[model samples]
Target chain A: MKSASPLPVVFAAFFRAGLRAKRTRVFILLALVPLLLTLLVRVVDPKESGDFFTKVMLSLYFQLLVPVLALFFGSSIVNDELDGKTLVYLTTVPVRRRAVLLGKYLAALLLAALLVAGGFLLCFLVAAFGRLGEAAAWGELGVFLGAALLALFCYSALFTALGAFMKKSILAGIFFVFGWESVVQYFPGVTQKFTVIHWIKSLLPIPPGEGGFLIFQLQPSPPLPSVLVPLAAGALFLWLAVLIFERKEYILSDNA
Target chain B: MSTVLRAEKLSKWYGNILGISDINLEVAGGITGLLGPNGAGKSTFLKIAAGQLKPKIGRLTVFGEPVWGNPGLFRRVGFCPEHDSAYNEMSGGAFILLLARLHGFAGAEATERTDKALAAVGLLESRGRAIKAYSFGMRQRLRLASAILHEPEMLLLDEPLRGVDPLWRIRIMQLIKDYGRQGRTVIVSSHILSEIEAMTSEIVLIHQGKIFAKGDIHSIRGLIDSHPHQVSIRCPQPRRLAGQLVAGEFVSGIEFAADGGGLTVRTDQRDRFFSALMPLAAQAGNEITEITSPDDNLQAVFDYLIGK
Candidate 1:
C-alpha cells in the first residue's frame, strides 16, 4: 500500500504536541518581554517611543531574543527526539528520514515565527501608537518582521544541522550564539559580515550613527545581499540538516 | 517455512565493548524467542534487526532486504522497542492514530486501526488518557499497540512483557502466540527462561555476545538440568537435614554455612531433590525458613554451558 506522506503527518502531530509543551509556554512568556518593555517605554517617554523602537527594541529583538529563541527551538527539532528516546517511532515507520527531519524543522520554524511575530506586532503597535494611520509606520513594522523571520530561519536551520550532527549540540549552539555570533558580528571589515546578525541588522531601518548606543560601528550592507544571503544560508543549512539526518546513524540506547 | 529475517556475520559494539559478535542467524515465520541475561547482547541484536543501530561489521535483512537506511522495509515490518518511551503529552489514542496515519491509513481507517490495536492490547478503554498518566504496564501495552497498529508481516518485540502485571503478562503472551499462529513472524526477547518457554519451544540462547544455543526448549532445558545446581536451605537444624539428605544418589556434595544455621546441597536432579526436601521440611521440628537456588539464573547456567 502506498503510504501517506510522512512530512505532513509528522508536522501535524509535532505541531499539536509543541503547542502544549512547556518550552512553548516558556517562550510565550519570553516573547512578551519586549512587549512589556515597550509598554513601559511608551508610558515613560511618549515623544521618543518610535525612536526607541527603531534603535533599542530592534536590537533587542534581532540580536538577542530572536537568536536565543531560534537556538532553543531549532536544536530541539532533533535533540529532543534523541533525549526522549522517541526517535524509534518515527524512524521505524515507512517514511524517509528526510521527511521526518524536514517535517520537524517546518513545525519548529512555524512555532518560532509565531512567537517572534506576535510579540513584535504588539510592541510595534504600542511604540508607533498615534502613527498607525501612516503607511510608512506599517512598512517599517513589515521590514522588522521580515528581518526577524530571516534571522530565525537562518539560525534555526544552522542549529538543526548542528543537532543532527552531534549528540550534545546545545553546548555548541550556546557557544555560537554567545561566543561566536556575539563577538564576531562586531569585528571590523568583512569579518563582521561573516555573522548571521550582520545581514539581519542591515535590513533594519535604523540609520547609521543614530543607533550607536545599541549597534555601535554598524555598517549596513546593501538590501539585496542582506535578503539573499540569509535566504540562501538558511536553505543551505536546512539541506545539510537533512543530509546528516538521512545518512548518519544515531545510537539511541547504550549498547548492551 | 520461508525465512522472514536473515543475518550474516552480524556484529556491533560500543567503543571496546561488544554488542553482538560476528554471528549468523535466520528466522522463519513463527515465534522465535531471543533468550539471554542482562547485557547479553539481546537488545543489541534486536536493535540491529529493528534498524535502530547499524552493524559495525556485517549485515541484517528483513523480507530479503537490508534493514538499515531502508524505510520502505518498515511497511512490511513492525518494531516494539525495549525502551520505555512515548509522546507522553499525547493521549494513547492519538499516539496510535499518528502511527496509523503514518502507515498509510487515512481518516476513518486510521482511527479504526488505532482502536483495534489498542483493544487487542487491552488499552482501548484508557485510550483517551495522556500517556504520562498510564502505568508502566499500560505504557508497555501502548508500545505494543503502536507496533501492531499497521499489522505488518514481521514483529520484533524487545522485552515486551518486562513491566506488565501478571494478568496482562498472560494476555500479551497469548497475543504473541496468536500472532504467530496467523503464520506471521514474531521475535520476542526476554531474560526470563519461563517467559520464553511459555511462548515458543524454539529459542536462541545468547551469552557474552554470541549465540550459545539455538534449538528446541526441551533440549536446552535438558542441558541445563544436567548441570549440578546448588540449592541453599536455611533452617535451625542443619545437621539433621544434612544427615537425612546426604544418602540420596542425586546429592553430589554438601557444605555447611559459616553461620551454622544453613546448608547448601549440590544435586544433579533438582526435581528429585525438591521432592525429597518437601518431606524433610514437613517433619515435626525440622522447619525450613527459606529455600533458594543461588545459581539458577541464566548467567550461571550460561557459565556452566560455556565450561566455566
Candidate 2:
C-alpha cells in the first residue's frame, strides 16, 4: 500500500500560519534586543569596547537570549495546535503523528534560527566595528553564531519534548529557562558541563589567550566535547519530542 | 449494503468522566442524521469514527479496516469539526486548495476542485478574504468547503449548518442530501430534532455518548409517541374545544384552562391529534384563538423520552 508523506504538508501549513501570525513581530523584536544592547555598548565606548564584547555580550547571548527564544518558539509549535484546535486537520490526515510533530518542529526551528541568527549577525557587526580585516574579529562572530544555533537546537528540542508530553508546558518551560538552565549552567566543576550554555560558552573565540576569564573572565571549554555534547543532546531531545508527540493523544476540548 | 462503518460495544472515557459508552452501530452509504441534545455523545462518536480519538473498548471500523491512526482511510473520509477553527491567516481559497492538494490532487485538478467547492458553499467571491475577516456563517461555509473539496466518499459533519443563514442552511442541507443521493455516506449531527427530521428519516439518537436509538424516524417516533404529549390551546370556547377533543381515540386526557380561555390536551398520537385539530379549528363554529404544546419543546420531549 502506498503511504503519503506528511512532512511537507505540515511544513507548508505552519509556514503559512507563521507568516501571518502576530507573534512573529514579537519574535522579530526579541531577535533585535541583543543588537540594541551591542549598539549601546559600542556608542558609549568606541575604542575600549573589547571587554564589553567578550564578557557582557557573550554572557547575554549564551546565558539568556538563546534559551528564552527556544523556549517560546518550541513550546508554541505544539501549544498553538492545541489552542487553535486546528490540529484536527493534521491529526485526521493519513500521516503518522510523528510526521506532524517533526514537520512543525522543523518550521519552528527555522523561524527561531532566522530570528536568533539575524540578531546575532547585527550584534556581531556592531561589536566588530572597524575590525574588518582581522582574523580574530571574523572568527569570534562565526563561533558565536555557531554556538547560538546549537543552543537553539538543543534548548528548543528539550522544550518541544516537554510540550509534547504536557498540557501546561509553558510553565515548565519558563522554569527550565529561568530556574534550571540559569542555575545549572553556573554550577562549578563537571556538573556545569551538563548544562547547554556551558558547551555554548566553551566554543567562543573571545577572552582569547585565556587564563580563567576571556579578555576579562569569560572561560572557554575544551573545543571538541563542547561542540559534540550539545549536538548529541539536541538530537536525543529531538528524538524524544518526536516519540511523545506521535504517541500522545491531545484532547482540545471537553467531550460529551 | 456493505457496512462502510461499524462499531461494536465501543466505549470511551476520560478519567472519571464518561466521554461515550457502549455504542454499537453499523452504517452504509447515504445520509444518516446523528441527533441529540448538546453534550450528547454525537460529537465524541463522530470524532472516534473520524479517527481523531481512540475508543477505549471494543472497536470501530470503516471499509472493514480499523480507523484509529489510519491516514490511508482519510482519502475516502472527510470531517467538518464542530468548533469554528481555521487557519485564520490563509485566504479561504488557499485553505480549501491546500486540503485538496493534501488529498493528492495535482495541478489543475486541485484548483478545479477547490473552485468547485467554494462555489458550492457560496464562498467563491470571498475566496481571497482572510478567514479571520469572514463572518461566522461564511466561516461555517468555508469549513464545509474544506470538507467537500477533497471529494471524500464519506463526510462526517458536526453541526455543519450551525451559524448559517436560512437560505444557505437549506442549500447546504440540499448539498448534503445530494451527496447521499449520489451514494456517498454522510453522518450529520445536530441537537435540533426537526432539523435532523428535515435532513433524513434515518437517524441515530445519542444521549450521553450512548446510542439510544437507531432506525427510521417513524420507529423513533413510535418510541416517543407512547409518551403522551401535552398540547395547550387558548380559545374563547376553551371548555367546548376540550369537550370535542377528548372524544378522539388519540387523546388520552384533556383539561380546561383555569383562566377559562384554553385547554391542555394529552395525546399519545401526535400526528393523529394534529391532523384532527386542523379541521376542527377551521370548522365554521370554531373560535380557537391560540394553540401551544409544552411537550413540543425539545427539552420536555427529551425528558419524556428518558422517562424523567
DockQ of 1: 0.58
Candidate 2 per-residue lDDT, tens place, A120-155, comes to 778777877788789978877778788889889999
Per-residue lDDT tens digits of candidate 2, residues B212-296?
7788998767666666677777678876777777778998888878888878888878778877887788765666654544523
Per-prediction interface RMSD? 1.5, 3.1
Which candidate achieves the best lDDT against the true structure? Answer: 1
TM-score for candidate 1: 0.89
Misplaced by over 4 Å in model 2 are A1-5, A208-220, B222-297
In the predicted model 1, the residue pairs found to clash are none
Best by TM-score: 1
TM-score of chain A of each: 0.97, 0.90
The candidate scoring highest on DockQ is 1
